[model samples]
Target chain A: MPDRANDPTDALRRVDLVLRVHDHQIVGPEGELLGNVDDVELAEVDGRWLVTGLMVGPAALSQRLPGKLGTWTHAVWSRLHPDREPTPVVVPMEHVTDIGSAVALDEWAARRLARTLGLELWLREFVVSRIPGAKGGSSDERPGDLVESASSEATEAAEGGSESEAALRPRPDGRPVSGLLGRTGLSPDGERLGRLRDLWALGGPRDGHPEPLRVTHLEFTSHRLGAELGYSADDRQGPALVRAFFRWLHRNDRVVPISALTGIDDTGRTVTVETTHMRHPFDQ
Target chain B: MKKFFAIALGILTAIGGFVDIGDLVTNGLVGARFGLSLGWVVVLGVVGICVFAEMSGRVAAVSGRGTFDLIRERLGPRVGLTNLVASMAVTLLTFTAEIGGIALALQLATNVNPYLWIPVVGAAVWIVLWRVKFSVVENVFGLAGLALIVFAVALWQLGPDWSDLWRQASRPLVPHDESHTTYFYYAVALFGAAMTPYEVFFFSSGGVEEHWTAKDLGVMRANVFVGFPLGGILSFAIAGSAAVVFQSQGIQVDTLGQIGLPVGMAMGQLGLALVLLGFFAATFGAACETGLSVGYSISQYLGWQWGKYVEPLRAARFHTVLLLSTIVGVGTLLTTVDPIMLTEYSVVFSAVALPLTYFPILVVANDRTYMGRHANGRLANTLGTFYLVVVGVAAVAAIPLMIITRAGQ
Candidate 1:
């Protein structure tokens, strides 16, 4: 057993036991299995790592803890489980299609997982052609596309990770028009100011202008202005005054216009809604 | 058979997701307090849940995203962080309440102080999430939770004036004894419990976990549509049992035992035993849901590989969060705070946090880039839109009503 009283990091380093079972799949981000790890045994003391033990069926797992549920769970698991002379499914790590922040397993692992996940049966009999009005049965409908959204999956994953790859993906067909940009940020000299939060028209009718996102009232949840970082909300007069002005500007849900934005970064989830609602009217 | 099985899976998820600890208590409390009158909120809440849960499912199915995923993208990092903080706090509170309910259930059965059982329950919940297969975890609790439908049978056996019960139910009102503020407070509480944010968090995350495609939407919808109302009917029967017994007798619900009183009064010891069994099953079932929900929110938001699918060592962060949250939940209950009170507050906070969770879903559902042709049609949008407003009003009014009603004294 691992010692808990010892420093966890140090003990974890000192821990020597290791286990590796062939066909032990390394499942990735979207349940993508990145090949079977042939070996998995932790290092101990100075440096000693090996696929010390082969872990196959649930029986091997139950050996970790000797108990009723564990014993029976392993027992039943090994029993009803189908194995006609089990030749372990093997896929070397070389088949790994893409390995970045997220490792994309090649079709081998994906297919195995899909089968293990009952995807084949689900698609063939249950899911497909079953909906009250499903379109063109299995013509161009990609099964992988079942989980992928061109805009959202790419964008959402990027937001949580890095944007470099997501930026390369195709941009949304529609772009924010000029009318939607609300307040633009400007330098003191009647220059254009940056726009604030875009109030999305949440729910609208199916057709006709899919909800024009009006850059709504600016809400400063946090005062992360570069110089304003350390300074508290009360400490900064610039933000406080600007916030007060906006409070007056946005007494109701009315749209206030500024000058045009110089540039907008779609990948950054930001709009440079540049406008001349300059802090000062008598500038320049 | 496979199609039917998938539909059954959806229904099972709904059944598992349906009656959290708050609903277990509040539905019964309200039933005892105002009978079927307050029942409208659950019905309203059911419609509200159907609209949002479907939107959430569609968003998850169409977009391959979760709640906080869309929030951070659309709300920006700063505000997204704020939303995260608020949403996580409320979710954690619900997490705490569910764990408390689990321990309380044990207490009801074993006559042991729930405080002693807190740690044990917490550990059990974490272990199941860690090792147990996701399908088994859901199905076991879901099937066990059906044991709670006994409340309906007990209600029928009580043999009371059906007309009076039906009329009061048809016309829910602020009871004469209870002030309007108190009545509205409970109403919001009921609404919040029905539309708890974790429901969608778990639902969408589960969709992602089960690898749901647009094809699975029908089974998913079947789960939300049929299962929630089935759960809703169980909740109504709980209220009915209370109304037949407690309302006329001037009894009020202040504990789990009080809520079970109608059953105890009806069939003596045997009925009481069933109610206790129901309590244990429902609370334990909810503990599993809320427990998974904690891991779901944190991991989904961070985009950490999470779910019952992965081994414990691989998704260390997800399991770690689950462990810590469970510990905190157990500790909170150990402080001698009443779990029932915790359940009530959860419903209120659930109400307050509704708009934050639901708004993103509503937005994402309407996006053509996301949902494609699957984007919500007029009927869905109309219902979804109206509920959004309804949730907003309930959220806005919930806090003030609680204060005015003095926690619905």
Candidate 2:
């Protein structure tokens, strides 16, 4: 057993032996009640499961409850505050700035980080894209020629129309879409590459901004083993056999840099990237 | 005229597809034992289902994601997984009972052993899941299920005093002979039967499968609002018929055949035949629903590709789960476990599991992030909140009542 309490690193010390930080209180630099940790956001890098961020907000707290009670809490909250965007506020480790008695963060920096959560990217990329009649030339709508409407329609369709924007920003509910942990990844050529299993981010901000932590590398997997629990990412954590099984399952895991991403489809479901920019981070 | 026909078709099918084996058995049992005293629970359950189904259907139409998908997303892994496990367990159990119901309905027609029909029914359900179009499957069975309206017709044919049946239903109370615990126990069962989680699962997933858009919201709402309450009337009819035929003589309804006995007595062989046809279709439709729901909740949780809209080969894992669930259903029935008993237990368990499925949908329905302009209105919120409280109370009371009544002896 590892003695995390005696660990020199503050972040490492805050996390117990199990590394379970859920329900831990999150506070600002001056100890303001930002929220409690609803879930831990993780990313895969070099065969490791590193904590990427903490998900907070009422939505996050609702998720912390184990079972239908969580759902009811979320539902009641949603109904009572429909105008508030239901997305949980995510504070990436980059914006975490400091780790101490309260998982401290600069208030403004944390709010800024919340806007660019992987969850919101997921909502824009996957959920919003699948909205029926959301875009033209959809799977159902074959673009039979009305040549004039076709061009504008093509542009709108390529943009995933205005719906993607609506999804990125909350509409009636104040909830901003965040968290993109489980969205499927599609190549630039529309070949089904794999699911976006996890993201890789450098710890802390570089140049006074957390942009360096803006998903430096996206881990994609054709397998489902690490999609939920992220077991494949941390190859060394689980039992040897289980770890070996996940490694075998995710042997084909591909890591692509953010630079490779070209245009996300209008529906926001698929992220298109130039394969030329694909650098295998694992080989490093 | 064409639009009119389409709307009418939607409404007819909605009414027809409403009742399943749960409703049939619970209503029959309630009617025989409590004599319409528990009828109010059906009304409340139906309203709850309509409110949630409309919300879920709307969410699916607008967001193109099903209930379990949103549930997992909103609730995170642990809670979502627990909900998935609980909801799937009940759904799979319901699936088993539905398959058993189909076999029993077959036995009613052929006098053959129900056990023999289990494998055959399972295979047929799998085949339909494998080959049928989403719409065709829903339409065929949904329309066929309308044959249950024969129960209402049979009740009419019985010439019971309308005033007394009305009085019994209007006055909600425990019967003199039945304990309050037993009465409420069956009330929860009736509520569970009417608002089984799988119905919303099927409804929302079906909306996504059919690619419902904002334009189709009217059709979907019509199906839920008008059709479901009218279908609730069918549940009342089943209960009412039993109240007239069996309540006076104190005949307890325990078998699938006993559920149809009221119809058999009122309309003889032909009415019985029609009701059996209704039984076969209703259970088979729900069997398909519950089976697919098991796959839906699991696959949606894991973020795997799912639904019949995709080719079976494309969703191999989903198809695999469906196959395994069907096998389990068949195996359970092969143990000679009584399906009617399963149906009884299923409703009670469903009551316990109610809050799990219902809460997520209510949350997602109110989610402005997803619903946009289609989010629940004030009226919807009021009714939804009221039902949430009712559902919560039933959920809390279900287990104790079950134990106290010894699963409603």
DockQ of 2: 0.03
Worst-scoring 10-residue span by lDDT in model 2 chain B = B363-372
The 10-residue segment of model 1 chain B with minimum total lDDT is B72-81
User: What TM-score would candidate 2 get against the native?
Assistant: 0.63
Q: Mind giving the per-residue lDDT tens digits that candidate 1 earns over B1-409?
A: 9888868866865664578788888987887777788978888998888888888887777656666666544443345556777887888888888888878777777999888888888888877765677777777777777767778888888887889888887876667887777788889999998899988988887787777788777888888889988888887888888878888888888888777777777778887777777677777767777778877776554445466665443344566677688888888888888988998998899899898888767655654433556766778777876887899899999989988888888
Cα RMSD, model 2: 19.1
TM values, all candidates: 0.64, 0.63
lDDT score at residue B139, model 2, on the 0-100 scale: 87
CA deviation > 4 Å runs, candidate 2: A1-284
Question: Is model 1 an incorrect, acceptable, medium or high docking prediction?
Answer: incorrect
Worst 10 residues of 2 chain A by lDDT: A12-21
Q: CA lDDT of B174 in candidate 1?
A: 69
Best by DockQ: 2
